[model samples]
Target: MKIINVHSASLPALLLPLIFSPALFAADEQTIIVTAAPQTLSELDTPAAVSVVDGEEMRHAAPRVNLSESLGAVPGLQVQNRQNYAQDLQLSIRGFGARSTFGVRGLRLYVDGIPATMPDGQGQTSNIDINSVESIDVLRGPFSALYGNSSGGVINVNTQTGQQPGTIEASSYYGSFGSWRYGLKASGAVGDGTQAGDVDYTVSTSRFSTHGYRDRSGAQKNLANAKLGVRIDDASKLTLLFNSVDIKADDAGGLTESEWRDNPQQSPRAEQYHTRKTIKQTQAGLRYDRQLTENDDLSMMLYAGERETTQYQSIPRAPQLNPTHAGGVIELTRHYQGIDTRWTHRGELLVPVTFTTGLDYENMSEQRKGYENFVMNGSTPEYGQKGDLRRNERNLMWNLDPYLQTQWQLTDKLSLDAGVRYSSVWFDSNDRYITPENGNDSGDANYHKWLPAGSLKYAITDAWNVYLSAGRGFETPTINELSYRSDGKSGLNFDLKPSTNDTVEIGSKTRIGNGLLSVALFQTNTDNEIVTDASSGGRTSYKNAGKTRRQGAELSLDQRFAENWRAKAAWTYLDATYRTNVCDDSNCNGNRMPGIARNMGFASLGYEPESGWYAGGDIRYLSDIMANDENTAKAPSWTVVGLNTGYKFNISKVNIDVFGRVDNLFDREYVGSVIVNESNGRYYEPAPGRNYGVGLNVGWTFE
Candidate 1:
């Protein structure tokens, strides 16, 4: 079979009825539906690239500390840990967000119908509680723009719901580098039936601590999550969600090539300056759903939250002498709130059709301040301590968006989906600290866009399908990106404009021999792409580039060979480049975008019998990555392997599970992620060579 060839271009065509055989159908009969798609279509019927990970499967064998451990097998999505929790994880889809040094951009993240991405299109994944997750759905391709700004892709996380008798569970784990985790959870139904007047709830708390593999990178975190559901009546339901997280971590910072080669475990400048961060956040959301009629449904969601963060950087005192520079110590207190309402109606006119309309409003206001990183005595500055305030400002941001979407099944085997959204964003900033040393820097900016998306899917047969899609997406400059100017001027960069992207894709999926195989080809063009103009001493400035282009292909396969054996594989190849001449400290044109690998692949094998034991192994490989727009430095390619095994059993009315896993088993040395365009050439972030973890989970039912 062509599948024997790892890089067969026509493999999708060859994997016909074999993957969807009658024998296989019995094992995979569950109809999988995704919420990110407006139509709630089955995975096989949706005309887009998507993947769903079972949360139970992840918790069994993965570290659960980073989503990458579970999502690495997904094609077209890259997740990397920078070994610094303060910066969050490095995540990108088709190279769209490779330039980001901290947090996540160019994608939309949602948890239980609540938005994680702010109106500014920036998001953090640190608040996610893996223990409470029910499933993770990822959607990619042109149609992603339907989610609004910065929609290179979408990640939707759904938390588990209580059911049946009450249960209490406790889990704990210990791993290499002095890492440990402990968690407790309770879930059950408050009433008898699953219909009206019933109530269900789930609550969980977890604590994680690690000394870290690298010096000065230790961290401790506590997280709590709760969900409550009430069935008001047969036609209406209400759900409430609450989440909180507090974290304290020391930053190891980035390392130069020479520094990494000398000692990957060494901290370049962390201890001397005591660079660290303390962050606390609390959020709550309410969702209401009602069935107005047999064919109509309405849903509304409201959420509010506050986040407080204080960070100390290692910037030298000499840099603080520049009056125009932002200070080394940063403190931000932000309050954010949002509301969303949507209505869906289903009708049949010769065929099935569904229409959805929604309105969303979100706002964020912040009290931001900057102080010297060191104490001052007699005009002399001491590093690593918080000193006098050097800057202070109040920033406000908000967005209002209205959208309409429709899905039409024209025939038995053909479908069409279309949507449009109008988004308006406003920003206002006030300079509250006006000193003789600093200039008056009050500024405001506004951005608006109309995004349209559509897709067509044709089922060639019961087991095969083909699709085509296109969309327009835009990303606005974030508040942090606009806080400074390359010219060393004060105030935000009101002149900065949002970048617009147009994307087109074609894909096909087939079933072959108890397996599902999918392939996609896509291209994207971005105008006024944002690029880092300058970065130094933990400060960054952004400017617009002429244009950029990205083209890529992705392949994924999941096959079950036997009742107890299964295999999965995914591969992606992306060509992301600057389309026009660009200069930033280097010469012109045709450079590969920094921080993204051109080729990446993953493969895994697992065995689980009906009783007794389970085991799995995985391997990940990637090509070299460019470190800067100039492409002068590169991180070499590497491969890593991992293995895990566990046992499950029941005694009386209690259930128990014991598991262990080892990552980077071969002890390969490599850079996990890079700091793009770092001014001081400190671009590499080394990943741990080898690590092991063992965990125990116990649960008991109470009737």
Candidate 2:
């Protein structure tokens, strides 16, 4: 402790400007600290891998793209756009997740400290008004243990805060396929900070609509967000936020391989996946900081939020279930409601040793109301079903994570970081189903996990930094997974084991003269994986798979080649596969991991955005992928390109820029997602075919 304190005092004296000023930090320097780890973009001294997306690039790509679409630039990740506009936005991080039929299945998503994904791990980002965002920080790998639940990884979105200089911004855009959008944003300090405090606020709204390239896939969306900030003292602040979203969309169910090739933009069964959806998010938080002494201080925070959503999707009538069903009317209905709360505190324990302790509680419940007695016919399935297959679930999930980490400054070039978190969760469900095929049962479930992490970093030179670390994470079954009752299962079982994994990673970040490069290698050992089996003629059940392993490498490069030209490129290689099954017959022996691609990359080069005229396109390539867990058919690889160009203009406080994009420039045919039913009963639906779009953007700023 004495040694750590000695270096801190001396280093600040020699680095006063660099530590306090943001302009001095070069763009090539990585490891910027973020408030998610604590609110400021502080440099992380540990081996945690974090990525930041600036607001400028975000707006440029606003092609009104999904949050996941913009993330493709991040190495080792994939975001599949369903093109339906309603059920789109599927994201995968290192093959840790699969489908999101009801809601987000695995990853954790957040917006300005508020939970974006509900307590059930079904993430919601529809209210993601990127116009008011300052930046997005992503924490990947097990190092994300700091965020409870889906520690699979964390994406924390920080919105624009009020500045002393007031500003008002607005934009309107129009594109192909009957697409149109408009947005407005404003923020500023209402009161200057006096000896007592300061008051600030922000408000934003956006609305969009599209006829869509495919029939029955048209959509209309609206969103609004507001935030208020209060400074109680020099070191304390409180923020309150609210957001709401509404979407009326058409659901386009999966299509057969041949049908997709014949007409990629054609919507299948219009009555099914087509429905209206609504989501509302409310949040409030208080942050307090007090200087207990000269060298020691304390920071504490409390937050709470509520989310509600109503969603629906339709299914194809059995080929010939009945003459009425044959006409296409059967469907599926889903609803969800949730609340999240957390209290945390970080203290400078005896100076060099820092510690953080917090308790978090999340509640999520969903209701599935399916009407069985009603004839599954007519244009609207809900119109005919007379009996409701009602199911309700309640889960009490909570965890306590306390961590202590320290940097032992042994020398000017080396540092050490260590921390351990004790985490536990409890799950309980009350479920009932009235059906002739399967009986009903209600039960209780609980689980525990210990996650520890440690890292070491050595600064080889002023331009290079390297580190290594390892951590463990676990995910419990969601309510849908535990409470689901199909035609064959007796009831929800209790033998399901929580999924667990240990991830180890090594990485390096370097600034070589004029270019910046980063590379990371990672491996994960997984145990008790969750699997859903459907070998029987009429029923399916969930079980725990024995073991598996995931290993991958990621590389990224950003360079400025000329006064007006720059380029960015990223590549990912994953040798991910399941360990052959020892007890399975029929050669379930060696199979590539399901739904995972072996390689993927994106690259672009062109004039910088600052140029009066700018133009560029993205070339994205994905390697062949396995269609199922059994590793049967090898889906073909694909390459797609997109072009964008825009001219900048300014008029006083109002700024206007007109931009355009042509997606799938070559009009190639391909599918973003493919699932082969090993049972051979279901068909594979390929992704959308190439489509072109042109848009114009006009925006203004006011003071």
Candidate 3:
């Protein structure tokens, strides 16, 4: 007798029987299906790197549980927690968005077509709840032209819409670092299968707490989300959404090189600062489809949404004082509103020639304030320099884009796809301050630009495809990056030329039995890109790298085989280098771009028993990457492993799942981010050493 074991390249073949088995064809059951996705896994067919996160995988990677940790394995992506509430969460892809010390930039975030990124370039993606997601689409590089303002690719999160039958889920988690979390979800329809149309709704709520791995870094968070669906007919529907999140936490300030080694958790912020922030968002949308004379149909959409956030931040700075890192303050008040409308006609114009044309519009504005030596115990200390006039202002940006796309079947074995978009953006901003560049400009300025982008994809065979596409991408500086000027006036006051890039990609996609393999190679060149010039007078100033290029390859595979086994593996290599120097005399030219690893990948193998038990282990690897323009600061490549497991009930609406993960499983000490640091000595904060955690969940469904 022989026992068999199947993994990465063989699991898909093994899973075929169970997935398509006759046992799943119960006559009384209703089947749920996801949206149709793009074909081809190769780089050539996509002209971009796109990765998917399945809904089932979310259970092991809960929002308040393994949220940031599980995401570590995503290719070309980085996730970091600053331990400071004021500093926004760190998430960057391909070195596109590391400058954000307080908020997100250089990336576009979308959830079912509603923009999660603010118009002024600020974005919030931490709210994405894995439990509510149906699938997550990660589009890397400048390959996504259908979506505008995308400097990097797009992260499209599709949630589980209203369901036909009622379902309920509850989860609880506990782990080291004094962590605990609880979540609940319930969803279903109304009127016991109404006659007019089916209406469905979903609600999700969660709470979490953690004792700091470092002093005063602990945090508590509460969140909730609700969704409603109205069905107009079999071909049309509408959705309404609302979400809220609140957080209270202590701060983890930066540690000195020596202090970090003595105790990585030691920081003035740990004892002197506390922060509280809350965010609320709401959106409504209409989706419709009508068959126009059989082969031609009309599809339209209208969406409107808004989000508001408020935070009070205070920290003691070692500025002009001998001791007592005891007091300083920063307060942020932001509110945003926007809407999008699109209408398209889908049909064959001349037999085998199909196309879609649509228009898009977005607008937004925000209010903010900052101060120095702002004492929380009394009136804000008026300790300041000269010529500081106003403390309040409005910053806004808007864009209008129209596009056309067509797909043609050239022959029996060949087809073609093409699309183009024209976009115009407007900026209306105001700032009051005495600076070196503006001479205390008080009012406002308006700027506008036109951007055009396009792409092409072709199918070479039934099981394989190839694509080649080149598209233009542009990014405007953030509000703070533009209007901010402190003390001696050394901030950006120029019209701030837009950052732009163009890319070309080619690769092959193939599926053999239980194996799905995709590979792509591409090159991206940019001009007027934002980079830090450290040699500036006394501070790091944002300057154009002049020109640069980032080229790379991506390969990923997922397979399920053997009676109870599965595996997933992915690998990526990126090379980003500057093409020109600053001032024409510096050796910065040809320097490697920071935060882009030359080699990175992930591998995981899982197993299940004939009974109700399952477990899996995953490993991640990253190569050394430059952390500064001069290549003086570098973060050595590091690897970490993760482990998780749980179980499910075969019958009944009730099911239980338990899982745990250990970060930096091998205790590899390394700095994850170096935004404001450039020193070579002293390994920055040791990446969490061997973190362990576990979760438990139960779900129910009622008819």
C-alpha positional error of residue 592 in candidate 2 after TM-score superposition, expressed in Å: 1.3
Whose TM-score is greatest here? Answer: 1
Residue 12 error, candidate 3, Å: 34
Considering every candidate listed, which one attains the maximal lDDT? Answer: 1
What's the lDDT for all of these models? 0.80, 0.57, 0.56
Query: For candidate 3, lDDT tens digit of each residue in 1-703?
Result: 1111111111111111111111211232201011111111222233345666765665653435433555544566666655544345666676677655445677777665556776545687655665676666666654453455534555666766666678898988887788888899988887542334778787888888888677766777777777676666654555666666666655454454566657776654335434444455555555443434343445444556555554433333334132211113333455554544333333455546544455556777665444444332353333311111224446666766655555455665454545555545555555544334334333333333333333344456656665555556666666555653322242234544557777677766666567667777778788878754431111233555679888888778877788678788888788888898743345878888775678888898889664477888888887886656667766677877777766655466676666666666777665555553332232243345677777877878786
**Predicted candidate 2: what Cα RMSD to the true structure?**
7.6
Better of 1 and 2 by lDDT: 1
* lDDT of candidate 2 over 520-584, digit per residue (tens): 89998777766554321111245566787889998888777877777889898988766657224
Model 1 C-alpha lDDT versus the unseen true structure: 0.80
The true-versus-predicted C-alpha distance at residue 274 of model 3, in Å, is 5.2
Model 3 TM-score, all chains together: 0.83
Over the full model, what C-alpha lDDT does candidate 3 score relative to the true structure? 0.56
